[model samples]
Target: MASIKTFINDDFLLENKYAQELYHTYAKDQPIIDYHNHLPPNEISDDRVFGNMTKVWINGDHYKWRAMRTLGIKEKFITGDGSDKEKFMHWAKTVPYTMRNPLYHWTHLELARYFDIYDLLNENSAEKIYAETADKLGSQAYSCQNLLRKANVEVVCTTEDPTDSLEHHQAIAKKDLDFKVSTAFRPDKAIFISHDGYNDYIDALAKASGQEINTYGELCEALENRIAYFDKNGCKLCDHGLDKMYFESYTESEILAIFAKKRSGKELTGEETSKFQSAILLFLSETYHNYGWVQQFHLGALRNNNARMHRLLGPDTGWDSIGDFPQAEKLSAFLNTLDSKDKLVKTIIYNLNPADNEVMASMIGNFNDGSIKGKVQFGSGWWFLDQKDGMTKQMNALSNMGLISCFIGMLTDSRSFLSFPRHEYFRRVLCNLFGAEIQNGQLPNDMEWVGKIIQDISYHNAKEYFNF
Candidate 1:
């Protein structure tokens, strides 16, 4: 028998009796409502199938690419130039080195759940597992639609740019599939002035909205037009990817001056850039309030850190890192600025740094009144923190500081369909946390209440929060 087959029959979860009881009592059949993700809306609409397993899992996933790079695999094996087989082998070589990293767990879990293969991936088993999984990719069970069905996803929201055609989203909506699929408006390209193509993006926005981009007022009008278009097509959420919340107050005059400088084909200073960004954020927040949409801020990510690699492979190709900054003060000021004016929308704050987990979790409590218990939420463990230890820390902190009953659950933050297994990983961790509390006498063994709590965190909270 193969080592993987031996591990499969051995019942890994059964070794921990507490995990078994919790899995049976709390986590078996909960529906999944993924409120946030990076899945392409068009693929879901088309019910697309991958050309191969490597294409589906390795092509666009920077997470795996980063791990392969860390293991001294050449860039060719990652984002550079390499055949699918070569890249898969490079990943296989790195698997044994992953050891205690969450990547090891996620990779094995995906293999077992999807392929029904139980072998540990290493240099020895890599070729066999890859060939076997690749062969299975030709079957109907490995189709993209089947993957979502297997994961039991009830709803999925994909992040989309303002300039997107959304033809795929339209196709999916028209099909009326069992699961609800929608788009989240992500406008980082339009707002981030430091990007190389800021001027080009202005042209794109102008074309999309049929408005001439001459001044600041015109720019705002173009954005508003795009937002309306997005809303008409089933967008109820706006997502902002920023290093931190911008709270610097600026006057209309200041913004007009900055736009004039840019319109003249000149760059603004750092101070001017901050002011312009803050003003745009405020304008967007006001729009979110007007549309009654949920606003999500993915903060604390220091993107494009490695300039050499960034220039070599472009952005999001594993050049980003966790930022070290005091988010609470600025984030609080920004939220309060909106809250005081009664213009705050349904808000979720996700942090990258674990040290700020408690701070961000507790900060939500300061803004929550009796009006809505869970209106302001600390989102699921994000980016670098999307792992077993990170999820556990977030859950424990949120439960300790605020009402975990109202907490929304896991999101993949992934571009791959194979990432759906993440929901299962999160469920197991959640059950273990609650079960341990019960076993230790921290709480009474009321399976009903515990089950309800598990169900709410797993699915209900996200469904209600996103109003899906």
Candidate 2:
């Protein structure tokens, strides 16, 4: 908000001279380590190109889709069968409404960074802007691999299910691309034993692991085999998405009986479901520890709120919101269990609800034990809380309650290729925080040390954290 002449010039988010210097010098040119994202490895392997802007930019982009729907746009122009240009036009028309939202800045930043078009997109500029981007995207040079290279990304870990073949990841590894593309084991389908088609998913898991799951121990063995396979294929991280951390008490015998009943087509009661989930999650976390892999827990998301729309569209289509769950107690117990067994691997806890910022920042300290630098990380602002206010709150909390210096920084946690600018957005916000403190004399005037810290957070820490 401090007077800036250009919309997205060199000093876009950097307000003061100190902020400007920190961003331009320390953070700007650092290669990105997108430790977590949803980019399709197949596209990276095949170097897929798009025919138009809508295909790569808007399609499957729930962020833009939600904004378009909010502007009273019809479904036909959104996820419906409307033409690509029609969808792009609807999004262009919706851009101005997103003025104060992060989308406004992101839209212009992407346009500037990717296409070098500085014109504000709206009804008048939509046609020209769309055409210009369409031509660039249609070219072979703008394929998925080239797009990632353009972003200066060093490594990106895409999330995958247990039943995944990892074929695309295998092919990408064979290419020996300049940037490293890796996968994270996401075994949500195996953990959520109470959800619909749980047994069917287990059947698929059995097929993938080449094992028949008739008992609880066998299921764990199947998951263990897949973990070994993923580990062999260069996977370095694992991720989980849960409404809250589960830590219910139950014996192995009870859990076995519960799974047996479920496999026999009987539904588990609430207690049984909790116990089963807690058991499998503990098993997975311990296994991750054995493999020397970093683990991530994305908690507090309340997904699929609209049933009618869910029936039409399905999950992860912008229907998720923050869940106000009782976090600390169960999360602490779960981690403590692993830590007590000396089985807690490097962990990153991402809270969707900003209210838990301080809770998570302080919670990581309980089990850090000095075994690793920032061993238990309070992760970056995620999902619903990825904006400026949210990111600032998270960083400030981490700085206050924990050491922000050792932190592994921002990740897109996104599905789009252009979303890499979000890392830029986070770096600017981080520099602004450190730079502002320097301006006010809260921190030393030493630019060298401050710049070092900024560079570490920007790239070095993640590089070392994952050892990539």
Candidate 3:
């Protein structure tokens, strides 16, 4: 227990004096700009409080779910009918085994930061910690909005589908909250013509937009309507999750014919699918540019791999992994098309595959064009790569290829409200990197200038880049 305390102490990840000073001085107090995440806006609007630890922490955390499954925990105790306490116990038991995993750090960081419970979460500490968190969670002081306040979050932009009402955002706006809650338009379903339920989703989109979609033009108009609605509701950004970019050449008439065939319940060929996706994606990007909105692309996730498990548990239930898609040529073509038309908006690209880190790093440089500061950003390490080693590699890649000082850094991209400490984790890692360089005399001992850059990467850059 004493060793565990020392392990997670104030200078947890900071190994040297310069590293500790950089973190505690310049980076520790920056307000979080979580520009992309999957938190439910309704929860923030309603200010709902969880009943217990598992309800808030365990339920819907696919990261933890994946680790537990890998350790052979039964489905009954994980995402099944087992009681909340039972599931939590299983998680607590799994903590010691998660030693080298990022979960180990995140778990303790969340517990310490949110609950002030520094004890290592395991079989021995689970009961006491569970009871303590449950007691605090039941209070109004620990409600969803208050949780964001505890993290000193300045702004959080939740992702919503085009079919969303944004009523919750309206509800949140009505109150005088300390922090701001904005939303992003996610049009993945509208673009995925080859996926099952594509037409069904179009029906939902039509209903939401109050437009009838009978043709490709109508589909675009309906999407445009939703975009207008989202923009009116204070959405300054949009997000897309795709395996890779689609740059297939197709005429407007060809896309129209493909849409007509898909609407007729005929399965389109792979070529047709790619063409339709490319057309819609281009349309969406152009529209976003017109609205002056930032666009984020989360690419290379090979989602829902285990069909057997996916069928049983549904998507995003620990079934996705990094994909090795060839991202260079098509991505360049897509961005070049937008750039040529002078319609490329502020863009951030996140690649899940570590192999493409340098590729993504250099790719952003091609379109920067001196239009804006870091106009096309190689985004932070995401999903499986949002850890110490991964973040270091990503920073190193960007530093090698481009300007790291101009880099806008770190977002939770998480569903859990308690996950805000990830920003702090990123700060620690970032400071350590800069501090290590200074100590090695590779960088001059200029704390103020360097600290300003640290703060910029930690908070200021995103604040200015998103302009939210």
Global lDDT of each candidate: 0.84, 0.92, 0.94
Residue 275, candidate 2: Cα error in Å is 0.6
User: Which 10 residues in a row give candidate 1 its minimum summed lDDT?
Assistant: 7-16
Evaluation by TM-score, superior candidate among 2 and 3: 3
lDDT of 3 at 265: 96
Per-residue alpha-carbon lDDT of candidate 2 for residues 1-468, written as tens digits (9 for 90 to 100): 122127889888898989988999999999999999998888888899987888888888888888988999999998999999999999999998998889998998888888888888898889998888988999988999888989999898999998899999999888868989999999999999999999999999999999899899999999999999999999989999999999999998999999999999998899999999999999999999999999999999999999999989998887888899999999999999999999999999999898899999999999889978889999999986898989999999999999999989999998899899999999999999988999999999899999999999999999998999
Per-residue lDDT for 1-468 in model 3, tens only?
A: 423677678998997888888999999999999999999999999999997999999999999998998899999999999999999999999999999899999999999888888898989988999999999999999999989999999999999999999999999999999898999999999999999999999999999989899899999999999999999999999999999999999999999999999999999999999999999999999999889999999999999999999989999899999999999999999999999999999999998999999999999999999979999999999999999999999999999999999999999999999999999999999999999999999999999999999999999999999987
TM-scores vs. true structure, each candidate: 0.96, 0.98, 0.99
Model 3 bad stretches (over 4 Å): 1-3
Using TM-score as the yardstick, the better of models 1 and 3 is 3
Q: Model 1: per-residue lDDT, tens digit, 140-243?
A: 77777788888888888899988887788878878857888888999998788766779889899899889898899998999999899989999999899999
- What count of clashes does model 3 give? 0
Model 3 RMSD in angstroms: 0.8
Show where candidate 2 strays beyond 4 Å: 1-5
In the predicted model 2, the residue pairs found to clash are none
